[model samples]
Target: MALTIGIIGLPQSGKTTLFNSLTKAGAPIGGYATSTVQANLAVVQVPDTRVDALADIFQPQKKTYTTVEFVDVAGMGQASQAAKEKREGLSPEFLGHIRNADALAIVLRTFANDNVTHVYNTIDPNRDLDSLNAELAMTDLATVEKRIERTKKAAKSGDKKYVQEMEFLQRLQETLNELGLASDVEISAQDRVVTDELFLLTLKPRMYVLNTSEDMLGEANEVLAKIEKGEQVVPESLKGELKGIAQVALRARAEGAQVAAVSAKLEAELTELPEEEANEYLEALGLPQLGAERVIQVGYRLLNLITFLTAGEDEVRAWTVTRGAKAPEAAGKIHTDIEKGFIRAEVTHFNDFIECGSFAAATKKGVQRLEGRDYEIKDGDIAHFRFNKGK
Candidate 1:
């Protein structure tokens, strides 16, 4: 499955800079005012050491890694007074790109820069989040209200299904009216089937990226650590500069969302250096890894996705599938014909394969097993599907 994440934020939030760092695409970054509605897009290969190891073992003709498509969209929080008056929070062009995204990476500025001015003239991530959420809620409210009108007419036929839908739409309307996220509304599986068509912005799974200064990276990580440990209060000296970061972290935890910190300017500059040199520079800074890598890894997990592997002399490849995906579904990621004709899967955990040195050895040790169509695909699983091509 191909997954796309839309990178969105208020103007001057360093979203483009982060995108450049993540993809190394070298896209131009603009200032506070943007003149173009066009979005920057790139496909980033998901970094997995297992793929590299498999490649080394198999000496494959080609090595393929799973990928994530990122769309860097500008002009999210730019609704004018007239647009707000009409209950429209974003331009149709912006929504066109965002609506198709599988998930969202919301950039929140925490860095202070003297050269670039903030859209609001102050650095407050909490307030910025509120502004963004309110706009999303407004847009969703418009969507729900439209659904209610149609469902109301449909309910007149006395069908229980329409009545149920009407009830759900009204509840969504109420929630969106109060500036609450559609994600927060209590929704059943049946209701989810109905709401899936709305493409409500607030309903998407999101991660908050705190764009911090180079000097603030250590402090930001420390604060996030405390927050993760369920610390309710941070040090007094750290509060003034990191209050917004702490607040956003708390909210993300409460909502079961992911949060990451990155020094955008620092990372962007690092992209200009060679990989080895950049790693050395990061080591000198006492940082473990690139912030861009963390964002990609976390964003991958945020979508509840996992990777499975296929190995051979022809190719050693990584494939993506949703967590709990069945064996046949995972086969479909390779080829539709395989899914249609799937008989059974020979599966071995990655670690077992590594320890045994090869598939034949793993099978001899009973570490490899045959799985049926109902078997769930696990991360780091190596799979070979048996199927009748004539099917």
Candidate 2:
């Protein structure tokens, strides 16, 4: 199954714009009141220069890249004043869309556009982030409280496991009530089993996406310099905007969340152009790659996943696996039969294989090794498994 990351933010924060840029789906972009009522889902191939290089070397009939699924959820916000008193939690439909997501990309608007109205009627990324976090925390607190109550009832039966679970749930409830993230609390290996079942939003891996103006797409460093030197002294007209983005970066660093700045509008436009034209445009703008690509890569890594490569005359493909996955588990990604056969695997590092120019050459150079099923796969490993047909 493809790993999924959900895009979430306030209305008009560019969540849909980022989704369109990343997936090239051409989803509609609209004002604050025009939020998408339904989630938009797309699977996108992860771009890897190494994959392209290997494909060139092998001249394979087919080349495949690892993919990630992006779900652009509608903007979430406070209930209307009339309904605020009765609003207990997030809408059930919104929870359904986000519950299964492996990670989240919280898009925060930093650019000032008079034409595009902010949900809060102001341009403050930090305030927007806090607002969203509060809602997510409230949702998690509700989940934890319900679990605590149920676990308490079960513990009355004197089951030791239930008692322990009750204690854990209470602790989680306390943390959530304090407005702390579920991910921030440490839990035992055994307790993790229960936490995973809750599917708490605050527990998922998250990153910040700072949506800036097109003029600031590749000028983060320059923008920062101006901000640090004082906006008053800096002649740039967008100094205030740059300062807003810098504040978000600082906040993300303090909170240990990954953050990236992107001009979603620019990237969406670039995606509409042909590949060659896009590359040329990026070159003209002095950008190494699209901001959307960086966001995808960051989101992929945040999920704690790594890619291993397979190269051959027939096919060259990149496969995704958890960071510490063993050889058999990695094989299971391709086929259960391969994993069930349970044999040794021939492994070579990508760089070593590329240097040797061939598997035989790598073997001759003593870089290729026969690894058992217990061997843990590393990122960039080129693997060939040898397994018995009759298992």
Error of 2 at 123 (Å): 1.2
Q: Which ranges in model 1 have alpha carbons more than 4 Å from their true place?
A: 31-36, 229-237
lDDT of each: 0.88, 0.83
TM-score of each: 0.95, 0.90
For 1-391, candidate 2 gives per-residue lDDT tens digits of 8889999899889889999999989887764321235788999999988899999998999999988899988787844554334434566677888899998999999888988989889998888988788778777888888788888888999999999898888888888777778877889997999988999999888888889888776676455434444453322334666766777666665566777778888889899899999999988877778887888778867777889988898999999999999999998888899999969989999999989999999999999999997899999999998888898
**lDDT score, candidate 1:** 0.88
Per-residue alpha-carbon lDDT of model 1 for 215-316, expressed as tens digits?
Answer: 878788888888878887543445555888888998899999989999988999998999999999888877889998889877878989899999999999
Candidate number of the best TM-score: 1
Say which candidate scores most in lDDT: 1
